[model samples]
Target: MPCYLGIDVGTSAVKALLVDEEQRTMADATIPLETSRPQDLWSEQDPETWWAAVQTAVERLCIRAPAAFSGIEGIGLSGQMHGAVLLDERGQPLRPAILWNDGRSFQEAEELRRFHPELSRTMGVIPMPGFTAPKLLWLARHEPETFRAMRMVLSPKDFIRLKLTGVCITEMSDAAGTWWLDEAARDWSDEALAATGLDRLRMPELIEGSAPSGMVRPEIARAWGLRGDVTVSGGAGDAAAGAVGLGAIDDGSAFISLGTSGQLFVTTHRFSPAPETLVHSFCHALPGRWFQMAAMLNGASCLAWAAGLLKSEVPGLLRQTEAAYRGPSPLIFLPYLAGERTPHNNPYARGVFFGLSPETQPVDMIQAVLEGVAFSFADAKACLVQAGTQLSYAGLIGGGSRSAFWAQIFANVLNIPLSRYEGSETGPAFGAARLARLAATGEAPETVCSAPAVIETIEPQPRLVDRYGPRVDAFRRLYRALEPEFRNAPTGW
Candidate 1:
């Protein structure tokens, strides 16, 4: 049977997935990666490491399942969005890629907001420190020589795609996060690029996620033990592709992702900019579909940190908190480990635990952490609703969604029905594989991107509703009360 391969160049690792026409996983492999933080609030990674990880992942996948890897007909690329990978004319990176989590551009982001007062309105996103535009401005100011040497800029996955096909191209979904795209028009905005000292020539050619962007080079194909004619789809940003994996294409369809960074994503058919609230409005992986998203910079990573702190595994921690979830704990956690994105674009915001007392136990803290994340997603839902996007239900995906305890809290806190689909746990890699199928077969996306079988539906429980309702108010108020202090907090606190 013919198969498709989807590779996601994520922040912490590169994931390679192989799937057949019916969306059955044939083989999957992941290669670990690391980020360099030479300075405070700055994140960088070598683009060469990303390409090397991709190669290692693909090689392992082929070794694991040679039959499926040999039958692969098309390739799709997905990755962490908003990363700035500057390259020279020779197609070599001039400097380490500035990552999405990097905060060295916070001042530049504020400067852009002032210089281009209408930027949020035009770009449908507030220029946050995590965006690509401000990162470029930072480079131009701090590393002028390297900046002048930059002949092209690409997102993380596009850098890998270029290595594979010798083509530099990006899709609407990823481009939308770059602070350059005119999301409503589904193309790069001249004004936005000019503000960042970039022009159209430095930007990658735009394409829809499902469209054929290029083909694998002969050498890459031969080295990877694949066909030379493998088609390449213009894959999506990780969130958009995750939405596609959940089949959240129809208007008002939403999904709550609990990956390294959490996001509450709602699909929209029309352009709806909520920049005032720092909500992300971007193009969908599928053409003609747009989405409004509220992102939380901290997600499952928080739990991982907590697990490490408590000297226990995540599963054991959840089990220990079972009793604590029977009622709401007075302790409230702010899940802003990496600062925040939605509703507040405060990069300086630090994680805090409010209402902590002498009686608080580890179990209580764990429960509070889970509830805090749920409340954060609830805030995103409120922002979407306030912006006039009505959500009836949302699909739940990502690593943390594997925990029944957390999934239950998300459904009750958001007060919406949550559906868990089969195979969605694979997230963006699965979606990219489907996009690969679309590129290779020329099939309608509706036919190829069908939602997987729904295995369970979680509705809000009255007890959970009553318990978390008032706590949600406290969660919001605490952030507001502390916002000023957060702004005034000393550096490196």
Candidate 2:
């Protein structure tokens, strides 16, 4: 039986998945990765760690399913988007890979927004510190030596592709996040690159997400004990890859991705730029498709942090919160642990717990955190609507999809049905495998990208929806009231 491999270089972990021609997953392995924070608002990871983790994950999957692994014919790459990996002359990393969540480039992003205001529509969205271009600007100013020595720039997964294929190439979806890609044209913009003192030469070649970039190196194939020349497909950024995995390819197909960070992704048949709303409009993994997304820096990770602070496990806290659930928590939380995106593009925004009282219990705080995340999704839904895409329903995927309680909360908060599919949590990697199949077999994506079976659908409870109306309004008011303070506050505060 022929098999395909999908490897996702995610922030918290690298996941490797192997699937047979029948589309059944045979083996999966996840290897944890570490991020470094030498200073506040900075997140970096060693590119070498990603390479090592990929090897380990693939080795583990091979060991788990030797027969299936040996039949691997194609490989797909997927990972976190907007990470800036600077390479030196010998393709050596000049510095740690600055991640998507890093906020050190806020001022640079602001400068770009002011000077290149016209570029927003072409680039998909207003420049943010989290985007790759602003990171380059920040480096050019503070670490000019490193910037001058830079030979190339690659996103997180493409960096892994460099090791696998001995070629530096990226797909449209990932490239769209770089603040360099012309979204409507689905190609890199020379003018945009020049904004950061870069040219096309320093950038990777572009391809459609399912197109083959190059064959895996012979040494890499032999070391992994593969059967033939493994073709590596240009997969996608994690968000688009997740959309592919969920089979959300048609116009207006939408989903909610609640991982370490969250995104409200709506597929479009054409490039629909919504720069004013701060919603990302970019090319989809499949050809002739695009998507509008509202990205939030905080997601399920906020729950994990709350759990740690409350000295409990996530499962335990969720269970307690669910059991003690009432109409709504009086308290409200701003899930801005790493600042925010979408509706509010404030990187300086900090997390705040309001309405805290001596009468508040741990369960109330837990419920508030969950509701805060739910409210954040509400903002996402509103922004997508403002961008002219009304969502009828949304598929739920990523680590947070495991919680039925949270799914119901999102449903009530958004007042729309939330659908959860079988194996939704395996989103990016599974989607990558599908892209691999497309690359290797030259198969049509419609047959190959069929939506998975829906396991459950949570409908909005009318009473709960009505109750959340006031709370959501209050959430918006609090953010608007606090916006000026956040902008004026000192960074370290």
Candidate 3:
């Protein structure tokens, strides 16, 4: 049986999966890497670290199944989007990559908005600090020597693709988030390049995500115990890949992913962001399609933080909370631990806990976190509805989706049904494998994805929906009231 290799370069780790043509998993390996934060609001990682992680994962996978490596038919890669990786003339990294979570480029992003008012008018969104173009501009202004020596620019996964295939290339879905591509034209935008003072020539060749870029290099093949000529396909951004994995290809279908961050994505045939820039518009993994995405910077991270504080008593706390709650609690939480992305792109926003009284208990805190995340999603859903996209049901995935309690909370808060799939991996690694299979055999992504059985469907209780309605209205008002304060707050407040 022919096999394929799928590599996902995630924020905290690199995951590799080996699967047969039928998309059955054969072996898997993961390598964790450290993210550096030398200063406030900065995140970076070494490009070499990604390559090392890939090498280690491939070596381990080969040890588990020698035949899987020998018969590898193709490879696909998925990774964190919007990171800026620069290469010098010799294709060596000029400096550590500015990660997607980094917020040092706020000034540059502001300048971009001033220079291109048409961006909001045409694309229906404004450039933000977390995007690649502003990061590149930040480097250009702060580190002139490094910027002068730059020969090529790529995203995180593109760096690995270069090491494997000796080619520097990227896909449209990833490029769309770079602030360098025309979303409608589906190519590099000369106007954007001129405004950013970047030469289009420095950009890599763009290709569709499912198209093969090149074959594996002989040296890399030998090092990883794989055939030299294995095809390497161009992969996509993580959100797009995750959507593909969950079978969210058709229009009107939605998927909500809650990991370190949260995203509410709806597939659409048109390319348009909300008029207020509440969501992002980008190409999907499926060719000739697009999606509207609303991202929340701190979704599961807040819950994890609360859980850590409670430690061994987490289950007990949850159970106690279940015992005490006669109905939805009166407290509300603003889950802006890392600031927010969609609706309000305010980096200065801080997490807020309102209606806290002496009577509040640990269980109430846990419930607040759940309700806070659900409230954030309600904001995103409102944006989608205002933009004329209708979503009656949504597929839930990721670590947060594992909780039946949280799933029901989301269903109740959103007043919609939550669907889940059985035998599915949580991240984009599985999506990359499916893409690899489709690339190699000309099979359709929809066909393979449709076979997964529905594991469970969580329906919202009427009482909870009625209770959440007024609270969601109040949540919207609170953000607006605090907007000015958030902007003026001290750094890291």
What TM-score does candidate 1 reach? 0.97
Model 2: what TM-score? Answer: 0.98
Each candidate: RMSD? 1.4, 1.1, 2.2
- Which one is best on TM-score? 2
Per-residue lDDT tens digits for candidate 2, residues 346-420, read: 788889999998999999998899899999999998888898889889999999999999999999999999999
Model 3 poorest ten-residue lDDT run: 444-453
lDDT of 3 by residue, 97-160 (tens): 9988788888998898887778753444588888888888888899999988999999998999
Rank order (by TM-score, best first): 2, 1, 3
Error of 1 at 270 (Å): 1.7
What residue pairs are clashing in model 2?
none
Q: lDDT rank, highest first?
A: 2, 1, 3
Per-residue CA lDDT of candidate 1, range 216-240, in tens? 9999999998887999999999999
In terms of lDDT, model 1 sits at 0.88
Backbone collision tally, model 3:
0
**Model 1 lDDT, residue 426, Cα:** 76
